[model samples]
Target: MKLSCTECGQGRSITDPVWRCECGGLLQVEQRLGELDGEKLRRVFDERLAHRNTPYASGVWRYKELIHPELPVERIVTKYEGNTGLYDSEPVRRFTGVRDLRLKAQSENPSGSFKDNGMTVAVSQGAWLGYERFACSSTGNTSSSLAMYAALSGKASYVFVPEEGVAGGKVLQTAAYGARMIRFKGTYDDGICFLERHAAELGLYVCNSMNPFRIEGQKSIVYEIAQALNWMLPDWIVLPGGALSNGSALGKGLQDMLATGLISRMPRVAVVQAEGASPFHRMIERGLKELTPEPRPHTLASALNIGNPPSWKKAAAVLQATCGVTVSVTDEEIMEAKAVIDRAGIGCEPASAASAAGLRKLVARGIVDKDETAVCLLTGHMLKDTDALQRYVTREAADAGMPVSSALELEQVKERM
Candidate 1:
């Protein structure tokens, strides 16, 4: 249960709340791989379920042993955020030219975003570490999710979001959870900088990408994917990247499962980002092996509008280990991909759609074969930013607006057109 700095080799106890090493590198979990008896771990985890079996119901708890220690489990409020559906995607398969396609629909989680997976674990760890207050800088989803979980964990939550980010439904959701919502005039980048410089004095736990527990929770998604596929690894895992912690966690989780003999092969990880805010993509274009986060990233996919992601080094390690590739899609293409996914019965945020857009790009470039098995990680629900989505959808539906209530009437209008 000890953690280590990947860059400096400085070891620390897992209970410490330190965010980074003296070398200014992200701290990574460094667990001993003793001949891990997977069955034994499962048995112990199952026994602990008697207290509140619901934690084991989904997400991190389902793969509890991978990240959690053998110590007493802390109680925190989570919406049982993980273990989202591994939905079969025929449309995605056809579109991406990947014959076997599945979607890890994290958007179905309580807060309509994959950040819940991180928030739940971070909140649990905070409660365990005697922290009573939580805070983060988010575009939208993470702030709202952390606030909701903090409320359940008897912790005060503070969220700092950009003034523009507050335009979506996210601001209301965060406020509704009774979190201290601070709006910044700038983007998420400014908020992150402000939080980092001020967090210690404010006595607030910076629960953004720096917190190890969030990535630990995110690792559960890979475990769930393996379990859903009967422990078979996919050829690729596609997901949108902002802070890149989730992508990093996927690589680590897969490695953990491989070590434990839970799966046989490792998957190639693919990160998708909007073209307007693609620092990772720019790094690739420059023949750089890692992403050096910019200072003012902006995009229609607000969740991915991060300038300087704290976990950039860890993310580089992840891509290196997984032989991953990063792709960038234009905002227009992401919007089109969103419409396509929605037509396929999977409504998603722009960031989530970026994953599918990446797949399409891969197919166009003749990189991914039509028969390859791929999994698109849909990170957020479309409803998370309802106001923007409403404008988008309503503007498209303007032609059919005259007192059309029934489905038949809508169809009739379409037929007329």
Candidate 2:
């Protein structure tokens, strides 16, 4: 594997301590999978399911050859992340108007978010490079996941987050994991800018999605989804867009699978962005060649509040490659979808519900066929943002001047029920 510049095509060894190319472009990991026997590889992956060990037991590491093939097994750091369940929910199917819909609950990971999938690979890569300190800027999930992995691996971790707007549950998780937290009076984009500007000066290895190794780990999400479907590609893979790293990684993984003959076709990717923070969707709608960042994005979905996503270029490429589409949903739509998912007992954070919301819009517009099979990727668990859920459940009561609760006798409760 080699690191290649997405723009200038400059190449460097994967071990190079660099996140971007000299030409100001993001770096991507390019792996050469020579003459893969698709059927044989599939059997090998399935057989590893019985192995109750370190790397193979991990859903990400189980597909090591497709991920970081050059990275040694001894260098791996894993909490056996991944292996999240794919569920067929009747309510979700009915809401999205799809005949067969699957929810890939990435929230089931050890860290209660999909971030664990990427954090494992990134922390392991840092260890392999002899780095003992790591850092990142997060709205919530990334910080918690990075902190948990770094703490478990005996590495010092520092996290930068906006002074406000982050969920209490996520912040508490980061603190409990022992990461040194830094808060600044600005937006998530501001925190990211600070890390990019000062990572080298602080002697910190950044574990954000900008790290190619992180993307490599995230590719395993796509692999697991395909494996769950028995190697059959779905018609559409819908996911909420935040930093855009997950979508980019999914696209790259699909390309890898196609190259290896593991699958016959590429699944069309649909990226759902919050309406308030929809630079990617705007770019798609305006037929623009580049994204124009939102200056002050605001959304109830804290995770999707990012205005300027760093991985927009990579995500755009993925959409182009797969003939995919991008769409944005209002905060209200996001909350409505979240309520449905939660009511169905398949809870997800507000941002994760954006996939369901956008899929519904797509189906209504005939962009996604009602009869097609689609898998909606839930990025984080519902408990990651209890504040949002509380607000959602209380909004109507607050608006109506009704008490959220009332004192009642046992007989009254039984009568109401």
Candidate 3:
């Protein structure tokens, strides 16, 4: 496999540990396609899925041919990262006014977030390269995933996050997994700069989406969605955009599927971001080539509180190819959507609820047809940031029209006391 720069088109072999191009552009895993033996792939994938007891059955590794297939099985580090369920969420559908909206509950992954899908492959590649240490800068989910996978692969792990920025659940998970945790007194983008300065000198493998392999691993989400639908493509795929890595991967994955005849049509992709951290949405709406990132993005959904997303260029290009658009949502809307999703018994993090909130916005704007089949990607579990949830259902978000039953429960408890 070869890594190609999105800007200058410079190519390098996968053996190179470099994450970016000489021109400081993001590198993409340049993909090539050949005639796929559809029957054989389908049979083998179905057979492996039927077994479900081995690593080969993992939703990610089962599509290895589409990913990096050259690695030996022993070099693969997996906890069956994919294999999430497609939850038919009636509450979300009613709230968003989308008749066939299904929530793809990625929280079922081993790490309670979608980051595990990419981390498994990234750590596996590091193992193949005989790397002893891996590193990443994250808000929360990525650190937790990297820590867990690095531990399983017997590799040292280092994580950098904003001081007092990340959720305790993720920080605790990383520390419990024996990773060296470093807290920087800055934002995630600042942490990225910090890691870049130290990664090469320290001989650490930086495993952010800036590394194309992480995007490659995320492509499995597309494959799993198609497989779950029996190779039928949805009309739209709505997901929350933080660094825009998943959006970039979804567009490229769709192109690959189209080339391989796995799906006959294209799905319009929609990436939703919190209003405070919506550089991509701003650029798209303003028709600009680039954006000045938010100086200090603030949102209750901590995961989406990114100022400068590394994958912005790649994400823009892919969204253009697929006729996609970016949408922004407010914290109030996100919590209200979260409450509805929770009422449906399909819980997700506040950031993950952006899809539902944005869907409502898009539908109101007539950008998304309420009748079209749509699938929303829920990227993290509700427990990923429970403090925000509690604040909403208990105190600060009371005027935001949160579920009445939760407030009623508090009243009942007070009366009982």
The clash count for each model shown is: 2, 0, 0
Q: Mind sharing the TM-score for model 3?
A: 0.94
C-alpha RMSD in Å of predicted model 2 compared with the true structure: 1.6
Q: Model 1: per-residue lDDT, tens digit, 185-281? A: 8878787778767887888887887788888888888877886676787899998988787888888888888787777689998888887678876
Please provide, for model 3 over 145-260, each residue's C-alpha lDDT reduced to its tens digit, 9 standing for 90 to 100: 99999999889999998885578887888899999998888899998888778888998999998878888889989989998899897899999999888998888788877877
Q: Which candidate's TM-score is highest?
A: 2
The local distance difference test score of each candidate is 0.79, 0.92, 0.87
Question: Candidate 3 local accuracy as lDDT?
Answer: 0.87
Q: Pick the lDDT winner.
A: 2
Which one wins by lDDT: 1 or 2?
Answer: 2
Please list the residue runs of candidate 2 whose C-alpha ends up more than 4 Å from where it truly belongs after superposition: 396-408
lDDT of 2 by residue, 172-213 (tens): 999999999998898888988898899999889999888998
- Measured with C-alpha atoms, the lDDT of residue 43 in candidate 2 is 96
lDDT of 1 at 191: 78
* lDDT value, residue 164 of candidate 1: 74
